[model samples]
Target: MDESLRAFLEALDYDGEPFGMFYTDQEPPSGFAPKPGPALSMELEQSGAINWQEVWGSFSCVIGSIWLARKKNTAAYFEAARYGCMGGSFYLGFHQPQLDFITHYVSTGIPGTQVHGERYLRSPETVRRFFTEIAPRPAPKRFCVFKPLSQFAPGETPETVTFFGRAEVLSGLVFLASFVTDDFEAVMSPFGAGCSYLTSWPLHYLGQGRLKAVLGGFDPSERKFLKTDEMTFTVPYEMYGRFLERWPDSYLRTDTWQGVRKKIARSRDAWGEQAGQGDGKD
Candidate 1:
């Protein structure tokens, strides 16, 4: 494991849930429990904060619904999906390398009946193509990736990391990174697996231009986690929405999709007009 990752693991509360570090000058909300760290800077010429709650809620609605359908447990799976959606947005997205590692594990690991597992098994070539395509893209120039830290300061608490950036672009990066790595086998392994979802939280404001945040996954598996590689991309929010809207039909049983749709509809009602809506500014 890398020294930074080792240090981060050492800092964990042990009893506390897994956590990732965020680097920013802004005073985070009380829930965020900001702590002192090295002063880092970035040049984000074209980035800004978007309505993260809306983005997250929509993502949860779609993804959660799918999980619900697959697991055939509306109550449990929906809650997990809700938790994942909120948690991912709160964290500054998953590290690209971590996401890639998880993808590699799933694409090459055992096959199963779940959507992610079966899909990869059906088209290993397609999965390979995806990784190849994303591997060459540069990390987001407008965002700073945070180091994962396990510990919270004496008074610090784990809370959402605010991100500032183009919602459409960030959403696309997150969605694609997630899509290619949705490996169920790793997730079901006794060793915990990295999360597939990513969120872009706002970190700080630098005069006219604010710094955006993007972090990666840190699971509690016994395996030693380390950063291996980096990849990033962007897809329009509208495009993501369309994909999510069609995902269940394409991958799930009709009966399951119908049941899941009802839950999604309820979530949409609660989140108002933005729930599951496209990334195009409302």
Candidate 2:
């Protein structure tokens, strides 16, 4: 294993039997006896049964990518693919329940079966065309900047801000923005906040530097509404990686969230204070 991969695996706190296999059915593999205890809810869960093959396929892809990276000495591409896997795993886990419901219940019902049957009955050419038409194109280089609607006085247009960063970071941001914007907005709206980033600014990656983007929503001020913003600031790449390591999951802690908020607040307040001093001198 390459040093990086070895280091990553070593850092994980795994306590399970080495290469031990656990089965929900049948006896454990030869030489291993089943642990005598009631099966946990997770062990009994059948939600993933239908998609077990897909799960294996994803696992193989991740492992194969790492092996290929080691063989080809292409660590950069491997790291990117690893990051992609993190996002892909989160997406699968999030949607697995709905898929299980559809497969077990919906597919058994008349209306659902008819719809699914019709879809399955389509010609290969038609199916191919359908997917081809709907597949997303490569993400473009773009992002947007946003502030509160209240930040601007009545009749004044909001100013647009933009920044350029590393290509990988920019692409990641664009892909995530497109993927999560709708669902994010839906979830955030009930709390009186709207997404305020995408369509307002562009994200640029800053390479292996001390630059990072903090994805969090601005807390509701007097208006009782939160606004999503991608706040960029300087932080070591290792620190940034630690944050991304938890991507699409428990990535941000309350402390990091509050820290970003304070950073932005400080920047804004400093700018306002400087402007006030200039006005006084005039």
Candidate 3:
């Protein structure tokens, strides 16, 4: 992590460290990989009972594991065939779901299959259109690694850097992102799975040669793994460097942001995040 960015985040009272995602051939240190197997089957959806332990042999939500990685200060990774969820697999460019079931599953129910719709979209057609428009890119390497920014070694570049924070922290991030570029839509909030925002869309913008930030964590299913107050801000590494260059001169340095910082302190104290720990700034 860059020292300037670190200090800026600290001053903002952002609680957690930012994490990075990258594709690599070699495994990462202390990385948590999805359990080995044939991957989840839709047949299990219709089965009487699912012994998930017998199925995947462990807890498996791609975003959930990423949460674990952040809290534990470790790394999490996924392989092409071993990604746990069919939706996550598709988003990660590992493979498509069987018979395009994700479309219906995310929208309307598939009648007679025990598959109740999540109602995230209006209809299956809407989901299909989403898939068509996004056109996620395939994984570039054998292993997709996610770890905290501090863990990244020299020569290892991350495709995306993801931050988890409440609205105040995100506000700083949003303004700083826009300060680096003239684009009116410097930050984009697209509808997607938590993993899609953290991984897919940021990479998508990078692949298209556009530098933009992605505001995410709106997925209802993945909210359980995130703090009640938290959302995500994901950006391409190049954009992150721009933030490093511009934040010293941005509004983040002004008394206006300092007023917001006091509110951040209050929120953290109310939530017990600063329990008994004096940051010494007070």
Question: Each prediction's Cα lDDT score?
Answer: 0.28, 0.25, 0.79
Instruction: Kindly provide the TM-score of model 2 when superposed on the true structure, using C-alpha atoms.
Output: 0.16
User: Per-residue lDDT for 157-275 in model 1, tens only?
Assistant: 22222111222223333433244345222111111123222222122111114222233333332112221121121122232333334433342334644454455445344435343
lDDT of 3 at 94: 70
- Per-prediction TM-score, please? 0.21, 0.16, 0.88
The candidate maximizing TM-score is: 3
Error of 1 at 64 (Å): 8.5
Sorted by lDDT (best first), the order is 3, 1, 2
Instruction: For candidate 1, give the lDDT.
Output: 0.28
Residues 1-282 of candidate 3: C-alpha lDDT, one tens digit per residue: 578868866765677678889998888768677776455444644563445455446437888888777767789899865686767777787754333567888999798878898999999989988987776788788888889888889999888988888888888888878888877799999999889998889888877888999999999999888876788899999998887777778887889999999888887877766732322122
Q: Considering TM-score, where higher is better, how would the candidates rank from best to worst?
A: 3, 1, 2
Candidate 2: deviation at residue 147, Å? Answer: 38
